[model samples]
Target chain A: MSGHSYDAEKYWKANLRLIFGSLIVWALVSYGFGIVLRPMLSGIPIGGTDLGFWFAQQGSILTFIALIFHYAWRMNRLDKQFGVDEE
Target chain B: MSQFAINIMFVGGSFLIYILIAVWAKAGSTKDFYVAGGGVHPITNGMAIGADWMSAASFISMAGIIAASGYASSAYLMGWTGGYVLLAMLLAPYLRKFGKFTVPEFIGDRFYSKQARLVAVICLIVASLTYVIGQMAGAGVAFSRFLEVDSTMGLIIAAVVIFIYSVLGGMKGITYTQVAQYCVLILAYTIPAVFISLQLTGNPIPALGLFSTHLDSGMPILDKLNQVITDVGFSEYSADVDSHLNMVLFTLTLMIGTAGLPHVIIRFFTVPKVADARWSAGWALVFIALLYLTAPAVASMARLNLMTTVYPDGTAAEPIRYEDRPQWVKEWEVTGLIKYVDKNEDGRIQMYNDASDEPGTAFQAEAEARGWKGNELDVNRDIIVLANPEIANLPGWVIGLIAAGGLAAALSTAAGLLLAISSAISHDLIKGSINPGITDRGELLAARISMAVAIVVATYLGANPPGFAAQVVALAFGIAAASLFPALMMGIFSKRINNIGAIAGMLSGLVFTLSYIFVYKGWFFIPGTANLADTPANWVLGISPLSIGAIGALVNFAVAFVVANATDEPPVEIQELVESVRYPRGAGQAQDH
Candidate 1:
């Protein structure tokens, strides 16, 4: 029980920070690069289309998979750190 | 062997496997029925989630939608899969820690209000029922095609298959069955794509094949598709969307709605731990991505193949004579999905966009010079995927595999949705409220009965589909986004949201979304009774009704905070519950009364 609250608060803060960062990449790939900023990035071609178009169809899905796995890996580490992991 | 025998062998063989699994894993208790004994491995559960999440729409119709609409349809691909990121990060782990059987049970307990639970149930039922009707209809189509039965008989056949395994094994049965289904559907979806990709781009991997150079044209496959489609007077394959705001909002609605849906969320419950739940969501996306990544390749490749078939000699030159069309066209023609009429008294099939009003008048002028009166070839979008094997001239076994695969996609999702609906009735409504003291045996019986009832209702609706059956997918996602998702999120993340506040938020979201959709689609989607047209000019802020759910969610959050701040905070115990759920500690098998 030593430093339990302190560790929990720290763990949550870290988790939230990780989540916040993940979401930024999430939004950047899907909504930002995929939709809104598409025209600006239209000059950079990929697979016969612009980077934005790739992000919209293919890149966003691939990025989303990475984001989820990354969150899972990081959160599992956080769980161990905070001693909140189920044994 | 004939094609009919091969299809039956595949479909019948798959059905036997499902029934054997269901019999082997029959549910002995409500716990097994509800959460599959709450000991499912994350990867196993993830495969089931893949099967559950990818419905008939994803398997059969989505590629067709992408093939038709091109870049604008990316919203469906990205929006659907992107929600898993939200699910893994925002919802799944905590809900698993909360240790509940049904979604509304969590809502009811977290909010400390029966009203909140009931609202959650309503949202789950409405959204799930609407979604399942489409699946039933889709299964019917697949059945009629392969079984040579009318769609009504096909619907009944689908319902019986769903009832057998879902009622027998419950989640345990469905979980294993869905793993089988995932394999079948993925093979069904990707094999034809692989063959077609190899044919077009010399790449067996469909996702990469999409970007590789077309072997015949010596240009990137997408570039070749764009040129081919534009030559036929269609818009550029990668054209920018007309309304970016609507696209953003539409994608947002699908994401949040995907996160909120009861069927998808419930799959996480079957996992053993909070950490497993998180990993399971990631695994689910991995399986789903296998199909999703190939879908664009399938869509673009199928479209190019279709265009080339029609204009055998370029569109500038003469098209092939109608009588000289390929075997695939004639095969599809018997199904009435493809039709060709001799326009301008020409024997050749002059298939091009003949619309004079569009900006591209160049194709129209060429058509006029070629003495074409109208677009003579009418191809249904649904045929793009269904006829893909034939289009690629694959063997009979592949076509049979596709038959079984389509049914697997439809049946797997239908069972998942039916489970969600039945559990809401048996566990949440019956045991939680109507008969709180009901014995475990009695509740299990009730669960089975409701599962049977739900299947009957689903089949009936699927057989005699409403005119707007196709349009209700947006409604399903809209309600889920507006009502259940916000309420669940607030219940977990906001300790200050009292019962009154949670109830207010749910009602506001439900009413706002429902009214917006009803105003455009008519009350209950009764045709010709809408207050205003569903066109873009009459839209609020140019946001279509499909995109209004994102705004509705904002309304929910805003209303929830205002009401919560004005009123009282949630009780101390509930606040502590939120704290406990936030961590991964002490999650055991889901508790049964």
Candidate 2:
């Protein structure tokens, strides 16, 4: 029982860390590069518009999809590592 | 066959397919009814979620909104898709681990109070019902235009079709049909976009075509769009027309609201495992991105086509003669969505900004010199996607496919929302709170009855839709973001929030968001009943009612924290339950227990 409790705690901590990491990138691409820092990226052009327009409309969505898949893959490995994975 | 006949065949054929699928995948037990027996493959679930998430707004109006608003409307794309990231990381996996038939069930058990459960149920119903109204209205419009019926008759036919499938097979049926709907809608959406993009930019991919050089102008499509629209007194397509603060807040509100919508959240529950739930969100976005990425292309291309059609040469060239208008214009005019009053009676159609505002002012002098009267062409934004095939001169089959796609989009979402509402009533209200000992058969019967009632109510509302019915869908997102999201997130993330705190937080958020919307959008959306006009100047701290959900969420979190800290901590068992849900272990067999 004690070992199980310790594993659960460790799993929870690892999960939180992964979430924090992913969310930082999420915020950066969306609110940061997409809106706030867009002017800085205006010099770099993609397709027809500047990089910021790409991020706002197309790039952010692509990043989000990538982030979710990464999180899912990483969490599955972590679940196995912590001996908490479903059979 | 006539285009109308083709449309009927396509729409009617899709309905027939849905009915067939519903019959084959009939939900025999409550588990099957509620969460498709928790056996859905992640990719399949993803496609279903894609169909379920892209409502009438996304299908029928989103591209039009983007075409009209340009850069500012990217908020919808970003907000809608970004929320799934939050859902995957913040809510979905943990909720799946908790393993319940409904969202409110998790609230009830985790908070250790039936009152908290009931409050969550109320929030779910309010949000889902409001969201469903928009779907019903969208379906009605599609039907009225294609089937040559009145909007009311359209609503009834839509309601009856939805009633048969959703009530019969519940989640199980909705899941498979949505997969089919997703295929139809995606194909329907993309074929026209690809054709238009190729014609406009010499690029096959609409997303790339948006940025590629225009075939005719030999300049970038967006740049040319900006030049022409500005010449005609409209804002540049790539420019920021809205205040920066409003844009940021609006995007934030939509992202949070998207994460909080009950119907979308419930999709995760259908997957077999927590891992499946996480991956399914990624896959769902993959499916949705197919449309989201193309939408801008569709919008820009459609705008370019419409502009060139009306102008016939360039923005500086003389406007096209009304008598020489394309067949599509006359076709759309029958729907009353596109009107031409000919205020100048000048024989030629004059399309320009009529607003006595800053942007309109910029174009007013130019328009006046041209001897143009007030803008004669009042093209409803909703008509853009519906009329896109015709606008692009795509084949009649493509037009027929779009009608089917639009109806599929609306029906798929309406079915999803109806299932959510019915489950809340039968499983949450009747079974969970009212009759814990009710048999499975009785509960299933109750589910069908509740679904029938919900459909009737939604159809009736569709017939006499409030002026803000379209906007009410946005308000639904606000409510979901404000009330349900915080509580659900806290239940998994924090073990300390008690029943009293959760209930109080939900009530405050719901009330605050609702009143803010009512004050601006009319009291309960009653026409002429608003206390103040819904303008940026009249907003509280410049937060429009459309974007007030973010503040409501903050209030919910703050109040919940304050109240929880002031009271006794949650029980040890509830704390342990939260700890359990945080891990993905032991989630394999999450039958509704």
lDDT by residue (B444-560, candidate 1, tens digit) is 999999999999999999988876677765788999899988988887777898898889998999899989998998988898889999999899888999988888999999998
Off by over 4 Å in 1: A1-4
Top candidate by DockQ: 2
- TM for every model, in the order presented, reads 0.99, 0.97
Docking class of 2: medium
TM-score attained by model 2:
0.97
| Model 2 chain B: lowest-lDDT 10 consecutive positions | B240-249
The Cα local distance difference test for each model comes to: 0.91, 0.88
Task: Superpose all Cα atoms of candidate 1 onto the true structure and report the RMSD in Å to 1 decimal.
Answer: 1.2
Q: lDDT winner among the candidates? A: 1
Query: Share of real interface contacts recovered by each model?
Result: 0.75, 0.74
Cα error, candidate 2, residue B242 (Å): 3.8
Model 2 lDDT tens row, A1-87: 123477778778888899999999998998888888888898998766788888988999999999999999999999889878888
